[model samples]
Target: MANRVIIVGGGGGGAILANLLQPHGFDVTVIDKSTSHFFQPGNLWIAFKGVSPEKFLRPIPSLLKKGVNYVNDEVVSVDLNERRVTTRSGRSYEYDFVVLASGAELDYSAVPGHRELLERFGDFYSSPENSLKLWNTLRGLKEGSFVIGVADPIYKCPPGPHKGAFLASELLRSRGLAGKVKVVLAVPVPHAYPSKTVADILEPELKERGVEIHTFFTVNEVDNRENRLVSLEGEDIKFNVAVVVPPHRGPSYNISPAEVKDQSSYVKIDKYTSNVQGFDDAYAIGDCTNAPTSKSGVTAHLQAEVVAARLLGYDARYSGRTNCPIITDGKGTFVISDYDHPPIKVRLSRFKRLMEDLFVATYWSAVKYPEFWSPIFKAYFDATDEFIRRGEGW
Candidate 1:
């Protein structure tokens, strides 16, 4: 009989792992709270390009392989000792191996007055409806300061706040409001980005585009009454329109032996193997794991590959690889790095921008049929490896 594998939270990592394992003699079941799989990267396009959110959504079942079981229900808890997962519907699943890919929860209420700010000004980082609302609010803006920043330092997509600022700057320029509206990007970090190499390359471009960069501006509260953002540093930034990426936490489901998770509730996993600290039969991936890497889909995808390979009895280990696309001035490049290296300098180009846009079209297929696409993806990764190692520009 095949080994029974139960995956929690059928997001990118869970779904991809299921697809990769189902055909390799594993009985894979994926449980998720939602029926729809959202292509999260498209949120920026929705906010900036006015793209419909529907274009980025697909049924979760449709994205899974036919042999994989899809359960649309909330997980209540997981008993690591029993190797059983209990759901809200009172059903229990026994698994020989389990993987957690629930991703991170967006906790807007973590910040005081933030929910009210979302209701009034809208935000792109939350949901599709909110992304659309943000675009509507932005298109109507005639002038004044347009503020974009992060409320928390550890939200998904480290470059997202900067992407918003850059995209908004371009949109305002297209709308003939560039001169009237000030694009201010405030970050909690001391640099424009966490990676000094990448930050150095991006800072000059931001200045050239006339974007105001405020460093060390960690959000303390959104003062809706005063129409200002108060920072922990005691600085207040007034804005005509604002969107702050909210705080993120791990899954709400209770995990037995609370020591499996950290103070932030993110699962404590071996960064190399993704094995939940003490349990070799269980693993965690994606934003839910306290891995030393950016919380992005690419990290999850690569980790999924490693987990699948290990489960199939092949020796595989995740090297903390991540590739995040960064856009500015309507062109794009990537921040590609691994445990052994920081991001190599890559020049922005239209081809890279096109590749970034093209991923949207292939994302579903890549998730649903990993075996078929593995060769092609291997070639891509190999090329990127050579590029990064040689310190060559693309």
Candidate 2:
């Protein structure tokens, strides 16, 4: 009998794992709360650019491979002792191996007044509704003190707050409000970005655009009444327009399972292998694992490949690799790095735009075009990247 593999959370990692394992004859079953799958990376585009959120969304069922079981339900519990997973609908599934890819959740309660403040303020981190609302709010603002705040250190996308500030600056400048508007970023990190090499590049660009950077600003409370953020040290930063990234925490099922080690609500796993410690047949990938890496989709994609290889009887170890583009106004820099090496910065203004256009086209094609396969799309992406890298002569 083939291995019965159960993958929780049909997001990027779980969806990719299902596609990879199904071809290898594993009976893959993916469970997700939402029936629709949206390209998360495109959320930024929708918020900053004028792209519609509908363009990035597809039915989750359409993304899965043939013969793969799709379960649209909420997971109630994971009984590691019996290797069983129970859903809220009372459905139980026994699996030979399980992959916890059920990513993190935003903890609005971590910062007092965050939830209530969002109703009147603005944020475009995850929710589509919030992204659209933020865009509407941004378009109407002609002049004010725009502030982008990071509520915690372990939030998704370390560069998100920076991008928000940069994009806002561009928006203000384009509207001829450069002199009338002031932009400020309040973050917990000691630098604009975690990677000092990348921070050096971004800091100057921000300064050039007149965006203030307040490093080590740990926001403990949201002063909604005063339209300001109060730091842990009791410092206050006022804002006319506020956009914040809320704190993140892992799913509760893993902690309640009593099988996996919990590292501050995240599953404790071997950083290199993604194997859940103390478990022989269980693995945690993506944001759910307590890996000392930025919880970005790129990291999740790389970790999924490692998990997939290991399950197929190969010695695959997760390489702490990340490649993220800090794009602003159709152009920007690329921050690429691995665990063993420091991050390398590359600026390819035109190439970045070209890649962005090509990706959106290829992404939707992969969904609608039957012959435009993922493997083929990947080959095209890899070849185009190499071609551009060599063409730039960097």
Name the candidate that leads on TM-score: 1
Tens-digit lDDT track for model 1 on 142-203? Answer: 98999986888898998898888889889999999989999999999999988877898789
TM-score of 1: 0.97
Candidate 2 per-residue lDDT, tens place, 294-370, comes to: 78777777677788889999998866766566766657666665566566666648677576667557754443332
Instruction: Quickly count the clashes in candidate 1.
Output: 0
Cα-lDDT of candidate 2: 0.77
Maximum-lDDT candidate: 1
Error of 2 at 155 (Å): 1.7
Question: Lowest lDDT 10-mer window, candidate 2?
Answer: 363-372
- List the candidate 2 regions with Cα displacement exceeding 4 Å: 254-259, 364-394
**lDDT score, candidate 1, position 123:** 83
